[model samples]
Target: MKIEAHDKQIQDIFSLGYFQIPRFQRPYSWERDEVENFWNDIINDVSENYFIGSMVVYQERKPYFGIVDGQQRLTTITLMLSAIRNSFLRLGEDNLAKGVHKFVEQPNIDNEAEFILDADTSFPYLQDHIQSFNGLKIDCDVGIEEQKLKNAFEIICARLEDEVPTSNSESGGQISMFPVDVPDPILKLKEIRDKVLSLKLVFIQLDNKSDAHLIFETLNARGRDLRTSDLVKNLLLSKIKEGNAKLDSAKESWNSLIRKFDDASESEIIDSFLLHFWISEYNYTTDKKLFSAISKYVSEDEKNANDLLKKLNHAAAIYCKLIDPGAHEWSREETDVRESLKALRLFKVKQQSSMTLALLRAYYEKRLTLRNLKACLRKLEYFHFVFNAITSQRSSGVIATTYSSHAISLTGAKGNDDIQAIISSLFNSLRTKLPQYEEFEVKFLELSYLSSKTKNKGIIKYCLSKQFGDKFGGIDINHDAMSIEHIISESTMKDGLSSDVVGSIGNLLLVDEKTNSEELMNLTVSEKIKKLEGKGYPLAKALVGEKFPESSGVQDRARSIAQHLYNSVQL
Candidate 1:
C-alpha cells in the first residue's frame, strides 16, 4: 500500500478534480446551525489561513476521485461556494462571481461542464438549483439530502445578505461584517474568496480500494470524529469472511440492535447500548473511548466475530425490555419482572444498566425467580432514591459494583435458592451503606423547592405519586402529567411566608395541570387545600380543608410525610 500526504488550499483542491461521494457514505445533512458556525469561522478570521481537517480519497477506475471520509464537509463547502457565486451574480459583480463559480465547476477536456462535487442522487438538485441559484422554488419536493443542501445554500445566502448590503431596505442600511465600518460588497466578496482559497487541508490519496477502506477504519478508530457504534460495526463486518451468509447474518444482527430501541434515534440507541454492554463486560467507565475498548475486545478473537454478533443480538432484545418493559410482550412468568422494570422507569432511575443486564441474563437462563427479581428491583429503587433523589449523589459504595458482579454470578445458579441468595446478599450489602431513617428525614425536610429547579419539582412529584400509590390502590398517576402546586403561593407570599418556606417540600403537592393553573395560584393555603379536595394523591387529599397559619405548621406536615416515606422503604 503506497501512501502519500500533501497539503492543498480549498481553491486549488476543488478546482483540480471532481470528487464523488460513495454510496456507503452518509448524505449531506448539515443543518442551519452548522452552516452558520462554519461561515462565522471563515468571516471571523479572514486575513489568515485556517486548517479545515483532512480528507481520505482513492483513485477509482474513472478519472474522478472517490471520497471515503469528510464527504459532509466537502459537500457543504461546495454548496457554500455555489451560494456565494449566485449572491455575487445577483449583485452584478461579474468578476467576483466568475472567480467563485470556477471553484464549484469546470469545463472538462471534452468541453462538457462537470461539477466539482458529484453527490450521486443529489447531483441533479445541486446542478439546477444550488449551482445556479435563481429563486428557490418554494414548492419543490426533494429527498432529505437535497433538502439539507438547499437549506445550507439558503443559510449562506441569508448570512451573506445580512453582512453585505442587499437591495432590501428593511435591514438598516448600515451594513457591516465587523463592528467597524462596512466594506464595499465586491471588496468583502474578494476578501471571502481570498480567505477560503488560503484554507488548507491534509490531502490523503490511496491507489488500492481495500487499502483505502483499511485507512478509513483506522482513521475513524483513532479519531473521536466517528461514532463508536459505527466503528464497532465496521470492525465486526470487515473481520468476517467475505460471503453472503456471514455478511447477511452480521447485517441482520446490527439491524436488530438498531430496531431494539424503536423509540430512540439510531445513533442514540446504538451508542448508549454499546456503552452499557461495555460496562457489563468490563465494569469500566467511558465516554469517547468506547470504540477503542470494543476494538481491543474483538482483537482478542477476531475469528469469532460471528459469535460476537450473535451475543449482541440477544443482548439487544433484553436491552429493549430494560428501556420499555411494558412495550415488550413477555410471558406470564415474567409479569413480576416487567412490573419491576416499570417501577424503575417510573422512578426515572437510569444508569443501572450493568445490574439490569445481569438480571436479564439470569432470567434468560431461568435461574432467577419472578419474586426474587421483583424484590431486587424494589431494593434497587429505594437505594437509588436514597443515593440519587434525597442525597443527590450517585451510587458510590463498593457494594454497588458488587450488585452487578453478584447479579452476573446468578446467571448460572443451580436453583431458586441460589438466585434468592444472590438477590438477598446484593440488597443486604447495599443497605449497610444506605442512609438511615433519620438521615433521610432530615434530607426530605431540607428538600426545599425552587420554582426554577425543575428537577427538584420532579422528585417531589415522584414522592407524591408514591404516596398516592399507597393510599389509592393502584390509581396509576402519571407523574409526567402532574405539575407542582404550592399550597401557599410563593408569588403571593401568603401568611407572610418567605419564598423559600413557601417553596418547601411540605407546601408542595402534585395536582393536575388544570387545577394548578385555574385554582391554585393567588389562593390562600386554606382555599388551595379546599380546591385540592377529592384528588387521588394522598398528599393532596391530606391538604384538603387543612390550615397552616404559620410556616412551622407546613414543616411539621412535611416531617410526617418524610417519616412515612423513610419507614415504607426501610429494608
Candidate 2:
C-alpha cells in the first residue's frame, strides 16, 4: 500500500460516497477537550501551511478508501468546503464564478456548457482563498446571511490583491506582506487550508483481495490492546469465515447491540464486561495466577469463543435494562439478587474460603427470600470479624495458628465447626423469623465493647455516629462533633501506667474538640478531670459512678475508666 500527501484539491478528488461510516468503527464524537484543542490548532496554523494527511485506501481491483483515522479532520474539511462554496456564490467574481460552480457540482456530459461558465476550473487556486474568507465570516459576530459569505469572500479577494507579496519583488528587499505573514483573516484561513492538506498521518493499507476479517484481527491483536468489545467483535467476525452472508449477519447483530445501549461509550461497555469476566469466571486462587487465567481467556480462545461473546452480549443487555426506566420493573429483583451474589463472591475471593460458597448454596437450597439472604450476609460479616481478629492478633505476635488447623478450628467449642454451626443456626432463625432488624446485631454486640457505667449508651452512640452523622438528632447524649480523646498522653507516660493503658480503647471518650484542645499536652489526667468538673460537665462523675461502680478510690477510678473503654471496643 502506497502513502502520499494529498493537496487541498484532494477533498474534491475523493468522493466520500454518501459519507457512511463503517459499523465496526468507534463513534464520531471525541471528548470535548479534544475537539477544543483541534479547533485551537486550526486557529494557530492560519499563516503556516499544514497537511491533514492522505486517505489510506485499500487497493482492490476497484479502488476504495477506508479511513484508518482522521475522520474528524475530514468531516471538518467538508463543512469548511461547504462554507466556501456558499461564499463564492455571493461574490460576483466572473472568472471565479464558474470555478466555484464546478467545485460544488459533479461533472456531467450534458452540463458541459454550464461547466465552462461555472467557477469550477479556477477553484483549485481560488478554493483556499474562498474557504479562508468563509471561516472569517463564520467566526465574526455578524448576523448569519448570504451577504456575510459575500463580504467574507470580498475581504479575501481584497487581501490577496493588496497584501500577498509578488514573486517579482526585489530579491534582497524585505516584503512587508509575504503570504507567510499576511494579517488578512482570509489569508490566515488559506494558510490553514494549505496546512491541513499537507498534514501526514500513519495508515496501514491492507490488500482488499485478502480476507478482511483476518487483516482486521491481525491489526487489532498486533497493534493496541484489544478492548473487550473489540475482542467480541473479532470473535463474531471469525465466525463469518465462510460467506459474506454470515459477515452481514454479524454486523447487524453488533449494530443492534450498539443501538440498544446508545448512551454507553465503547470503553465503558468494554471495561464493565471485562469486570464481569474477572469476577464471575476467572479463577482467582492467587492474584498473579488470577491475572494469568484471565489473559489466557483472551489469547487462547480465538475461534470457538461464541459462548463468551454471548455472555458479554447478555450482560450488555442486562446493563441497558438496569439503566432504562422502562425496563426497571422486569429487572429490579434479578439485579438486586445478582449484586448481592457479587458481594458474596468478592468476600469469598478476599477471604479465600470455600465456606462462603457453601453458605450461599445453603441459602439457595432453603429457598431464601431477600430477607433470608440478608441474614446469610450478616453471618458472613461475623466470619469476617473472627477472621480479621485472628489475622491481626497473629500478625502482632499475640497469637498464631497453622492454616490447616485454623480452617478446622471454628468447629469444636472454639473450632471452625462450632462457628459454622452458630452461623447456620443464626441464618435459620433469621429465615424463620423474617427479622426486621439487621441479623448482624448480635454478632456486632458480641464483638463490641460496652461501657460499664454508661451501659450500652456509649456503644450505641459510637455505632450511631459512624452509621449516621452527628446531626441525626434522636440520641440523648451530646452527639455534637466529638473526637476520641485518650485520658493519658502517649508522649508523657512517666507515671506507673503503661503505654497500653494510654492508648487503650477503655481510656478513649468522645469529647468536644474545644475540651480536648483546652486540656492540651501539659494537662495530666487528674488535672483534665478537674477541668471537666470545673466546666460543670458530669462525664468524670458519670465514669466514676456508672463505669466503675465497684472502684473504691481515685487510683481504682482511673484504672476502671481505662478498662471500661478497652472492653467497649472488642472486635
Q: What are the per-residue Cα lDDT tens digits for candidate 1 across 193-291?
A: 677677888888888666766777777656544677767777776666556733555655666666666565446666787777656655455657777
Best by lDDT: 1
Q: Give the clash count for model 2.
A: 38
Kindly list the per-residue Cα lDDT of model 2 for residues 313-402, writing each as its tens digit. Answer: 554554453334243343444443443333333333233132333333334344334564445544544333333321221222111111
Best by TM-score: 1
TM-score against truth, every candidate: 0.72, 0.43
What's the C-alpha lDDT at position 544 in model 1?
Answer: 31
TM-score, model 1 to reference: 0.72
lDDT of 1: 0.70
